[model samples]
Target: MITTNRPTGPVRAVEILLAGARMQVLLVRSHPLIPVVTVVQPVVFFLVVTARHPATADRADLLFAVLLTSLWGGTLWTAGGILRRDMADGTLGRNLVSASDPRLVVIGKCLGSCLLVLALLACTGGTIAVVTGIHVPLAALPWLVAGLVFVALSGTALGYLLSALFVLVRHPVQLTSALVFPVYILGGLLIPTSALPAPLAALARGISLYWAQRLLSSAVSGDGATLPALLVLGALTIAYFLVGNVFFVRVVHRARVKGTIDLG
Candidate 1:
């Protein structure tokens, strides 16, 4: 008989992550409405808003591009909300009993959400390019991708923090929608941070969304590229993951204490 030792270390983490990701895929496939609300709404908004000012082609193009980029926040929020709902309903608890880390499960779902966002962005961006007749700077595409990934991670962390609260509170979806809009607008999707009032502008500059948008904007805009934008985004990405990890651990501890995490 042949015997093999159990996996350990980073290799085990990767195995757990992949397994958790497959589970996430199954969950997403079962929930069709999530894609409609989470993915389609952003695309619809980009098309409608940009169409209003068709004559200002360049302005509309830039606005549409930024809008597409901002969809990461909504995607992450929706994914985290769904995960929290599952956790509260005890499905996640059942998964926790398996040989998988809860943190890895979270990571897997976040990655799956990010992949969905990327697919949506590609589809929407392609459609916009065709419908609006604007040519994207092909050379800047790599940087744009990098910025999107960074923003998605930060936004996912923020969503985790919010989901932790929603698990406990179970507030109305409309209220959550109302709460999320400012984060988008103030994130420089609608108005540039430099154009906002001084205090709000300063506050916006400190946010992960702000830095993410700035990095993306500088990459594709006619304005000169700025190294500082990349630096800011990198810093914000690190900060968000750290904060999110702390918040998630605390929430998990609380859930355990309250007996909220149990297999039904």
Candidate 2:
């Protein structure tokens, strides 16, 4: 691990975040799977789905679903393993001792992952547009952009929370693989919550991606109240951050007590 002077206060936090972001960028460059999941998989899924439902090819709403699905997948596979990668690389203990707040590092990594995924989403969207001829109204472009930003934020928060939980698991790969489709179904990214049973529909309301999809749908359709979805999405993001911080604190405490950060 690289070493540097331990700065104090907010500057330290910012530095830690930048470091994590840089680390994430480096990881993405080295790891071929990040792009495969974030870009290739989504593009292929979009093409396959559209081909199966030829009538829905031009629908703007489907584009939003595909984009959100990509975001969730990228977050789950990339940002979700932040701490696990650190532990495996033998840097988690060093990071815990060196950083004032390790959560900031996770946040930074999530932010970096989201940014990269967003760029890949743009490429995916462009490719989908060229192939399917899907179009968004000029007026709706602003809302769509705002919706994308919120989607990234919501994904980042969820990634941070998941990372904290994943670090404690013995087999995080199985757990991570298990999470993908359930979140897709629950989040309404590819499925409509209205089509789900009453209990599942109600449960979908708790997932941040559900609100994100609602917000994106509203943005694409220019129907429904965007404010409510935006507010709920923001609230959920804050809640995830708070809950993730608590989880990180507990994980740190446990690691310290056990004299090792590698719980897995």
- lDDT by residue for model 2 over 1-264, one digit each (tens)? 999786788887888788887778778755787778767888787777777778763456677778778788888888888888888888788767762677787799988887888777878787777776766678877877887788777777888888888887778999999998998887776778888988988888888887877787777677877779999999999999888888788779878787645743
**Per-residue CA lDDT of candidate 1, range 21-61, in tens?**
56655666546655564457656766666667566646533
lDDT, residue 76, model 1: 45
Model 1, TM vs. native: 0.81
* C-alpha lDDT of candidate 2 relative to the true structure: 0.79
Global lDDT scores for all candidate models: 0.63, 0.79
lDDT of 1: 0.63
Clashes per candidate (backbone, < 3 Å):
0, 0
Which one wins on TM-score? 2
